[model samples]
Target chain A: MDIILSNSSDQPFYQQIKSQIKQAILRGTLREGELLPSIRNLANELQVSVLTIRRVYSELESEGFISSHTGRGTFVSTIDSELIRESMRHLVEQDLQKVIQDAKAYDISQAEIIDMIRVLFEEDL
Target chain B: MSTVLTVKQLQKSFGSFELHDISFDIPKGCITGLIGVDGSGKSTLIKCLISLIRRDSGQVEFWGMSIDDAEQEIKNRVGLVMEGNNFYDNLTLHETKELIENAYPNWNEMIFQKYWGCRDYHYSSRTLLSSLSQKEKLIFSISLALAHNTDLLILDEPFCGFDPVDCSEILVMLREYIQDENHSILISSPSGMEISSIVDSFIMLDDGELVFHMDKDHLLESHMLIKGATSLLGNIPVSEFIKLDIGNYGFTGICNDYNKIKPYCADLDLTVERTNIADIMMAYMWRRGNVI
Candidate 1:
């Protein structure tokens, strides 16, 4: 699914895979109930250990982003629209928290922080 | 995830050295590095894998079928590059490519062209193999091997003639080749120091015996090179060691439990250093005697 690994990244390889899959699902690139490649296939495609891919799939499944059916294959789990929105909001809040912490650490004024947020929000938009 | 290659009690006897009761798994899509020093039965074991030489007594399986039964299927999937350029001396690079292209069903002409394009290696498909430099010959062989689209690439000392830049380039290519994960590589090389970083696991042979078959990380974690006063060596517990070598400076060894050895060494006021792969190999080969 066009996922690439960064050896220098703080996130482990499996986490990188999980995060990319989640992003793909959120972006509608990976449709709900779409079958994902088997652990072995994915591992082979990514040139990583099957154990690494297994960890990624397990974590994604546990997080309710995917589901696995024995012999059928792993598929992107269907999520309620409300739940998807809530999860996306939570992710954004977590990112905002980091920004707030950085702002405080930098001794930025509330106005400066607001201005920075506005610029970032506009750029993202 | 089926076993592509399995060797059960595989024994191969040379004039002076013999591989004794060798057994291992080469799982589908996994690159297993066959590591050993010169004349340590790496070549002998590979010959047995390829069925070039007769094994004393053992089972060899390739792709769910016995090696003897499925010779053609195994040969189709397997691509081998040994030390020397075994190509016809009179054949140019182009002729060599055409020859190998006709042999393998899955040969990719575009991929072959791309490989040549990526490197500054300009040899006339017509340039005779004898005219090419050693490095060029090795590169040509590798290019041809990769073009075969074999599921398994068994490379024996493919890096022999490569300089650092060329070696790195080859490593990059190998890394990309294994992207299919279904494609596995069984590489036997004395130059373990170069490829060890890229390999998934190591199969170390010593004195015609399987010394270790485990992940590279685990081997590094398990072994240590403890150096201290020669008197402190005796003070440390010897039972925990697999092998030990007393050097002029101090001593180094492969220990089963590094934690246990660390405490014992600490008690004796000795420092334990993290052992390199070469040191661990040397310790096992020399059986605790001075290797260097």
Candidate 2:
């Protein structure tokens, strides 16, 4: 797994790494049961504190995205299909929320917006 | 977290200068940066901890062994790299290496050899100590410390004379050294910006007293520099600021918890940015009219 960090970005280092890893896992770039780098190894690679990486690993573990075994190492968890579908729905909901807000500002009715979505969806297909 | 070294109510006095009731723990697998300006008793505190200078009162413990009772044993497991080069000038690097090797029973010749050739250092053991530049001497000192199987490394302003490239190399070396969860480091420096990126936590000292001891991430996340027109200051709780400076054109303040005043910043059109260790240090220094 590759992670890049930016000191100039507003997000803290830990958050950046955590989000990137989560995105990778969700996108299926990281497969289930795939081993993650050791905390020390990842910390060295990122030039971040070991504690920061530990926090990321612990949080990801708690969120059910990963799991750790003693004397072994961290690995991506086998996420439920429902969780993945829910996450995908959540992402669309966020984007659609913005689109609805924009449509409402333009005085577009809900039926009209639905019609436009249907037309665009069919065109893309 | 397990503590590698604990200093309890450590006190020392030198004429008008004194470190009053200094206390803190060096947690294992972490790099604790001791940040304070010059004359802040950083060196004095380090001396007392290393027993280079005796403390007036306090308990210094390493792995639960008091320094008073097991000074040699504790020293053996602790690596020290201070500012000055105490090795004899007449001695060649090889000669000094032999002396240090004989002193520590756990000394590893491989580690010593690896350090000199590590990164871009390319240091030779055949050079004379008197001929080495200040930067080279500092590197040599650190190399000596890491040569032993030490659990904790104590560095006092080790980057003072180093160039930026040299500093980064040393930082990487130190980071690699602490990969083992049992190892730790305590480093002292006048400038926080130099070590801010690598330190896990910061112990800030001002006028011989610890101003605050906090995790680096927590400090960075919470503290912010708020700037806006002087008139906008009236709309917010001015008392919440740790340090405030009012100017004719505008006002600038350091907020200990930016989240508390974040709403005001958004509503009042105040410019709020993440504050760094250097900014916090400057505000504290100027709080009492110190030009440092």
Candidate 3:
């Protein structure tokens, strides 16, 4: 599990960690039942406050991406296929939203964007 | 929330200098940074908290026990790491270790050996305290403190003389020490920016007075750095800002709360950026009109 944080990013540090871990779980890179690093260990590795790591872990647990056991430590949760598909779609929608905003700033029409997407999709196929 | 140490109306005076009604808590399992400029009474507060010097008034409790009531018990569990002047220069490391071992009954030889033998601090026991570098001495002091199984650490400007690399090494050791939820640290520094990332909260002092105690997340989130035309700031009340600098070219200022200033910025073109601890410190100082 690799997490890279950018200091210049507008996103808060805890939010950055939470999103990266969520993406890893959705992509199947972190398998279900895989024991995650201890919160303190992760905090030390990232050079962030232990409280920040605790917040990230608790938020992830609440969101159904992970769960913790009393002395056994935290582990990734078994995510359903439908949830994974939904999350993937959400991620794509976020990227598309950024592209749409940029296009509007440059005064590009929706039809032109659809045409460009069609060309790019066919080229990949 | 459980607190490791609690201070109430802690007051101390040295001739004309004084700490006025200083009070705060060191929460369990959190790193709290004491931020203040020179002569801000940070050192005096730490001294009073640890019972190094007598406080003129107020109550300080460590785990609910005052130093006068449980001096031995408190000394056993609390660690003190000052920048310099604690150790004897004429003694070898081995001799000093022996003295510390006798002072603290709970000292663990194994823990001391682990840190003393680590790659970053491979100082031999035969090395004299006077010959070791400042960083090495600091490492040794901290290692000894850890060996005694201290639950709370009070550090006074421990990062004063180190370069960035050496300073980070100290930070890494501190983070490792704080892994256990029972341990807590209260570190003081004039430069708050250096330790901003690791501190869970901040206790800011200005000229022997308590300025504010705030959580790190809220402190950084609520304040903002605004820069734009000086003419645009004419409408905004002066009381809204802690520091407002008006230059011939434009203006830059620090607002206490971004939400309150949002309405004023509707027609005024301004560049608003998130603030760091240093900027916040400067803003508070500028508000007090103490820029020295």
Candidate 4:
């Protein structure tokens, strides 16, 4: 997987790493139980401090997105789809909220917004 | 957290040039970069660290043991890549390894072979050092450093003239080595940005004086650069900025106290920009030189 870090991001370096890995897990780009690159290796690849990678690993472990075995290295944690579905739905809700806000600002009614969503869903098929 | 090497109040003089109170620590398992222009006492500090030149006064500690107490033992474990790639000009790859093997008790032929032949370096055992490419010479020097059971690898611009691929190879190898808990590296280069991604932290030496020392990530977070009219700076305190470049059109300055200045920026005719290590180094090096 390609993990690109941008200097322009306001997020702290470690936080950026955590979010990327979490997104990967949620999207299934990183499979359950798949071995992750060693922390030092990732740190070296990203040109970041080892401590930063360590912080990312620890935070990911705490959130159940990843797991680590001493000396054996880190791996993506096996996750329940119910939790991932909830996360994915929340993400969709955020996008829908933005669209609804914009539509309301344009004086579009709730019925019109619902009809637009229906049309968009049909277009996807 | 354990310090592998540290210099405290290190002072040395050579009639015309002097190193004044140079001090810092290289922690175990961390890569600490030294940055300064040439002749900025970087080589002198490395020599002092290895005790090649005697210091007038100050303490040099190796793994928490006094230098005098462990100098000989320490020499065996500290690997050095000094100027000139210093291998005998006509010696073959094997011949050079044979030479380094005598000085280091832990020198392993197997270790040398791993980095040597397996890393895309195809060579005849009789191939002379002078015949190898510049990149090849650097790899050879580092292979010796790695093979000798060296705990601390000290590099001084060994990759200066190397190609991008070779430089990245060197960085990757060093990081891989440091992944082993007992190894650490202290590397120095005139251009800090070249190794910013590779180094865990850095110490900047300016004309023989320690100017800045910090972890790389924190360095990025602690400061920001803003480009705008020079008149804007007149309203801000001079001390607010660590470096500046002023010109006819405007000025671009790095402010360490970025958070404090953020509120004031909203009303100013300027844009605050995210910065990288290279930009930071340039501003510091040219902080007060020719304007703009």
Q: Write the per-residue lDDT of candidate 2 for residues B130-247, one digit (tens) a residue.
A: 8887766777788899888888999988888678887887787787787777888899889788888678888988888988888787787677788999988889998778789899
Candidate 3 C-alpha lDDT tens digits along B1-292: 5988889998888888989998888889888999998899888888888788999999989888887799799989988887574989999988988899999989988878776656435566677889888888898898888788889988899888679899888888888788787898899899687787678888999989999888776677567778888877777765678888889999888889777786776457677778788879978987888874
lDDT of 4 at B41: 84
State the TM-score for model 4: 0.81
Q: Which has the greatest DockQ? A: 4
A best-first ranking of the candidates according to their lDDT comes to: 2, 3, 4, 1
Error of 1 at B151 (Å): 0.6
Worst ten-residue run, lDDT, model 1 chain A?
A6-15
Expressed as tens digits, the lDDT of each residue in B140-259 for candidate 1 is 787788776678888887777577887776777777677665788888777476676566667888778898887654566567656677667667788777776677877766676676
Q: Name the runs in model 3 displaced over 4 angstroms.
A: A92-125, B118-126, B231-240, B258-269
Clashing pairs in 2: none
Q: What TM-score number comes out for model 1?
A: 0.69
- Residue B116 CA displacement from its true place in model 2, Å: 2.1
Ordered from best to worst DockQ, the candidate numbers read 4, 2, 3, 1
Error (Å) of candidate 2 at residue A14 is: 3.1
Compared with the true structure, what per-residue lDDT tens digits does model 2 show for residues A1-125? 67888755656778899988988999989999999998877876775667789999999999888999988899999999897788678768978998998998799999999999999999999
DockQ of 1: 0.07
- Candidate number that wins on DockQ, 1 or 4: 4
TM-score of each: 0.69, 0.89, 0.86, 0.81
Q: What is the Cα-based lDDT of residue B150 in candidate 1?
A: 78
Q: Write the per-residue lDDT of candidate 1 for residues A33-117, one digit (tens) a residue.
A: 9999877567656655555677789888887889999879899999888868977897788788988888887898889988987
